[model samples]
Target: MSKIKVGVIGCGSIAKHRHLPEYANNNNVEIIAVCDIVKERVSEIAKEYQAIAYTDYEELLANPEVDAVSVCTPNYLHAPISIAALQAGKHVLCEKPMATSIKDAEQMIEAAKESNKKLMIAHNQRFVPSHQKARQLIEKGEVGKIYSFRTAFGHGGPEGWSADGVNSWFFKKEQAYIGALGDLGVHKTDLLRFILGEEFTDVGAFVETSSKENADVDDTAVCVLKTESGIIGTLAASWSYVSKEDNSTIIYGENAILRLEDDPVNSLVVQYKNGEVVKYELGGIQTNDAGGQTNTQVIDQFVSALIENTEPVVNGEEGYKSLKVVLAALQSSETRQITSL
Candidate 1:
């Protein structure tokens, strides 16, 4: 195949803002079709990209022209749509949180294995330049003996990002399953694991819906996590920050502290115990702003993995593990006790 013919399932905000534009920029990809339950959304996106439109995703998967698919649907539809696409002999690039539950995530992974097709999770934070650099630094032991950290991802809410605005499925429990925790928390879970090179073994959480009227899902979550290596940290996800998004991490170690995405000018900063301070001017994290150059290398990475027949950095199993941490947090909150992963 000279170029990968791609079908995008769900022409929602993510497709319109991230996946579609990135695929268009990749010369190795040719978008063959678009599917969405919303006819207007699918039609407009398909016309703009010169691809076939379908309201049903199964119809799009049945198109033999499509060699791969980007599943940008709601959390509830992720596993089923991805499994069907894989079964239809197409590679899948699924959005984060993998599925609403581990059972569904495992099922999707099993389907991918049965089909012998690539299955990558779109954990875009893992593709961020600063995050990549941070991982490199941590692996090199720049901060000796990691002790604790605090990471958070917060914004006004999904209303600003969802195509449906206030009425987006993000606030509905049936479609979203969980709110800020699933939407933003899982990203942090994946990122912290990537950065620290550790797996969380236990979690204690306080999840609540402090804001967003009529939202049945949690709008805020604060979790205390312990890693396998005994490192402790706090993970917070919130939709209450109305003014600006806070996507920052502070890693405290025996030697120094590393700050990530905390400053506007410098994406990374390190403070040594010897009183030496270093700042790195990496790029800014991508936001809802439309005109800036996108930093999410997810599309490019997914295409490369497909072409090279290699595993993506954030594959199905990786997504499943990160989601386990998020789910553990929810369980801990409900039971009022620490949950073991």
Candidate 2:
């Protein structure tokens, strides 16, 4: 196919603000359809993009013209929609946290393998320049051996991003499955995994609905992780930060200490044990909260992977692995003990 015909399933804030716009920007993609349970939302996005609209995702998947799909639905629906899309012979780019449970994520992976279709999860932080640079440094042995690290992602709350404001699906435990951990924590979990290139072996955490008045989900969460390579660290995620702090990993290695943060300019600060401290400031790659240019970069990579017949940078398996860390952390929080991954 000269241009990949794509369908977007889910017309929520993520679809409208991130996925659709990024897909629209890619010249090699032709958005053929949009689907959402809410007819008005689907119609609005469809009209905006000049594409057909459907209330049911299955109908959209059945369209012969659609070669790929962006599964922008809620946490619970991710697995079923992605699996069905792959079964319908369409490549899938599902949103992060893969699914609410490991079983569902495995099913999605199995569907992709069975259909021989690509299944990529949208872990956009992996595409950020600063994060990429950090990975490069680690791979090149510039930091020697990673010992421990800290990462975090925080914001005002879901009310600002959700279409329903205070009554959003993010607050509904049944819909979101978990609270701050799934929404913001997963990103850090994925990022730590990506940067460290190591799997977490155990996790201990504390989670609570500390600030949100009536929300059933957690507003704040903190976790400690032990990697298979003997590295240990902490990850913090919150939807209650009055002033957002998108700070992240401070990797201490034998040779250097690397500090990464997303404020005053995205940057990676490295302090060598030899007394050399270098700070590389990356002008924000994309819009901050929306993950701006990184979203487009990730989508471009996914499409390129399809055309090249190669594996995606953040495939279903990788998404599942990252999600396992979050799941272990949640289990740790609930049990007040270290949970094995």
Winning candidate number (TM-score): 1
Candidate 2 yields a Cα-based lDDT of: 0.87
The sequence of per-residue lDDT tens digits that candidate 2 reaches over residues 176-274 is: 888889988988889898899988899999998998986888899999999999999989989888875565668889999888764455477888998
| Alpha-carbon runs more than 4 Å astray in model 1 | 290-293
Model 1: per-residue lDDT, tens digit, 201-296? 999999999999979999999999999999999999999999878999999998889999999889999999999999999888887653435748
Candidate 2, clashing residue pairs?
A: 286-293, 287-292
Score candidate 1 by lDDT.
0.92
Q: For candidate 1, report its TM-score.
A: 0.98
How many angstroms is residue 97 displaced in model 2 relative to the true structure, after the best TM-score fit? Answer: 1.2
Shift of residue 116 alpha carbon in model 2, Å: 0.6
Residue 41 Cα positional deviation in candidate 2, in Å, after optimal superposition: 1.7
